[model samples]
Target: MKRIHGYVLLRESNQGIPNLLVCAFDAEGAVQDLLGARRGAERPTLTFGKLGKRIGSVLTGTDGAFELTRDDLHFEGVESRPDLVLAVLAPEDVVDPRRPVALPPEQRILYISAVPRSEAGAEEAYVIRLQQAQLDAFGIALDTSADNAHKRIAATQALLGDVEAGTQIRAQVAGRLHGRLKTQHRREVEFRDQAKKAVQLVALPHGLRAHPLLLSEASKLPDLQKKALTEGIRHLKDAHRPQLRISLRAAELRTAGMKLDRRGKPIGKINTLKLADVLRNMLGGVSLVRKDEVEPSALSDIALRARSATRTRARGAVDRAGEEGQGKALAREPGRTTAKAVKSATPRRDRRK
Candidate 1:
C-alpha cells in the first residue's frame, strides 16, 4: 500500500502564528523526490499534475493531520507558501523486499507551533498572539479528552451492542452506572429566570418575523422562545434568500446598544435595558399589529430606508458639531475674538471724528 504524510497550518497574520507540519514517507520512496524539490516563497506554487499521475485523496482531520494509502496520493492546499522539506532517511535508503517496508522517518512526529505572519507588523503582534493562545488552549483540552485510553475502552465496549458473559459484562455494567451517576444537574428555577429576562424584550404581539433586526433579537431567546425563534429564523432566511447566514452580524446586534469592537466583531453579550428600549421603539407605532399582519418584504424595505437616513443624519450632525467646536476654540484663542473685543479696545478718537 502507498502512504503519504501531510499537515496544515492556520495563521491569522504572517507575523507569529503556529503551524502544524506532519511528514510521512511512502514505501516506494517516490514522495521523497517531490519533497526534496519543495521551496519557500510568498505563495509557493506546487503543480501536482506534473509530480505524478492523479490518484485518490485523503482529508485532514479537525486537528489538521492526515495519513493516506499509496493510491490516496493527492495535493493538499496550503494557506501560505509551504517550506516543504523531505524527512531525511535514517540508517538505510533501500527497503527489504522480503518483508513489508517500514515507513521512512520511522517515527512520524507532528510539530504544531504558532508562527506570526510575516506581513503582520509589531503593532498587531499582540492581537495575533492572543488569538494563537486561545486556539492552543482549546486544542490541548480536546486532545486530552480524545486520547484518554480508559474513555476509549469504555466507549468501544458500549458500541458492541451486546452484553456477553464474564468480564466484558461487568465492564459494561460499570460504564453504564458511571454514566448515570454523572448526569448533569441544574436548578430549573435559575434557568427559568434567565430565560424570562432574555425573552422580555420580544414583543410577541408585534410581527416578530417581519423585521430582520427583531428576528435577530428573538434568535438570542432561551428555551421557551425556541419554537417561535425557529419559525422566525426560517421565515427570515427564506425572505432574505442569498444574504441569509447561520450567524448574526455585529451591525444587527448594535440595535440593542451592544457595541462592536474596533474590528466590527460582536462577543454575544446582550444589554437587556437597551434591548428593551429598541423593542419599545419598534412596537411604538403599531397597536393592533398581529404576528402575521406585517409582510417581511415591506418591513425589510422600511428598515433599509431607516438605516440609510440614520447614516446620513449622523454624518451631517458630526460635520456641524465639528464646525461649531472649531469656531468656539478659535474665539477663545489669543488675538482672536468677536467684534466686541475690537470695539472695547479702540480709543476715544472715533468719537472726535
Candidate 2:
C-alpha cells in the first residue's frame, strides 16, 4: 500500500473566472471521460489482470490539492496520469466596450508524488513543469512523426502494390475519391430535407407571405420557416438580385398577407400582415380613376391580377398564409376576369349595354 499527495498550482491572477481540473487513473477511464468522470453512487475500481498493476486518482478541492492511494499493487507497465487545469480571472483594467481582446494564457506547475513498488519504502516527490511553447512543440512532433509518417507509409504501400501489378493506380484512386464524394453528397441532401421539414412545422402561414426572400434560396428551403421569414424580410429591402427579389416578393405575397388598413388603404404593417395583406396593400392603395372614384369592377380586376401574381410567384407563401382554400373562393366570384379580359370588356360594355 502506498499514499501520494500533492498540489497543482495554476498561476493566474485572481479576477473572476472559475478554474477547471481534470485527472484520471487508468487509460480507459481517462480516454472515455476526456475531461473527468461524473460522480456516481458507486465508484469504479481499476483492475489489474495477468499484468499486475495499481491505479488510484482524486482531484484537488478549492485548495488545488489532490491525493492518490493504492491498497494492492500489481501491474508494472507504464500508467499515464494526465491532468489539465484552467483558471479564468478578470483583469484589473476596465475592458474596452468597442474592441475586446482575448484573455492572456495561464501558467501551470504540476507537483506529483509517486511510491513505486520496486522501491516500496521510498517516497519520491516529482515536479513537472510545462509551458505553452513546450506543449506546442510536443504536439508538432507527435503529428509529424506519428500521424504523418503512418499516413504516408500506408498510402505508399497501397499505391506500390498496384503499380507493380501494372494497374492504373491513378484511375483507381480517382474512382475511390469519386465514390466517397458521391456518398457525402447524398448524406448532405438527406440532412437538408430533414431540416426543411422541421422548419415547416413551426412556420406560421402569415410569416411566409410577409417575407418572400426566404423562398428564393433553394438551399435555405430546409431551415425552420420562422427563421426564414425573418431573414426574408431583412434582405428584401436592399437585395440587388432581380430574380431573387421577384421570387421573394412573390413568395411573401403568397405566404403572408400584405399590409393594409380596414378602409382598403395601403399601410406600413409589413411587419404584421400575412399573404392576404400583400394583395390588399397593392390593390387597396391604387385609385382606378383620377377625376372621380374608380369603378368597383376595375378595382376588382386589379385585385385579381395582384392575387394571381402572388400565387404564381410564391406558392410556398400562399400555402403558409392558409390561402389555398381562398383561391377557389376567388375563382367562384362573379365578374372575375383576367387583366386582359377586364381591359377589353370595359370600353365595349360602355358603348353597348
For model 2, residues 205-238, the per-residue Cα lDDT tens digits are 7757666554645677767577777777888877
lDDT of each: 0.46, 0.44
Q: Give the TM-score of candidate 1.
A: 0.16
Residues 1-353 of candidate 1 have per-residue lDDT tens digits of 23444444234432222232233211222333434465453222333332333333333454445554535444445322222222211122234578656533322222211221232221211111223454453342234444355456667887664545556878888888876655532456667779878876554657665654444545465654676778888888785646533343455468665667789766556777766555566568433445755557757977879979999999999999999999988779686666887888778898578
* Deviation of model 1 at 88, angstroms: 12
Q: Which RMSD values do the candidates have, in order?
A: 40.0, 37.9
Best by lDDT: 1
Q: What stretches of model 1 exceed 4 Å from their correct place?
A: 4-20, 25-65, 74-153, 156-162, 165-353
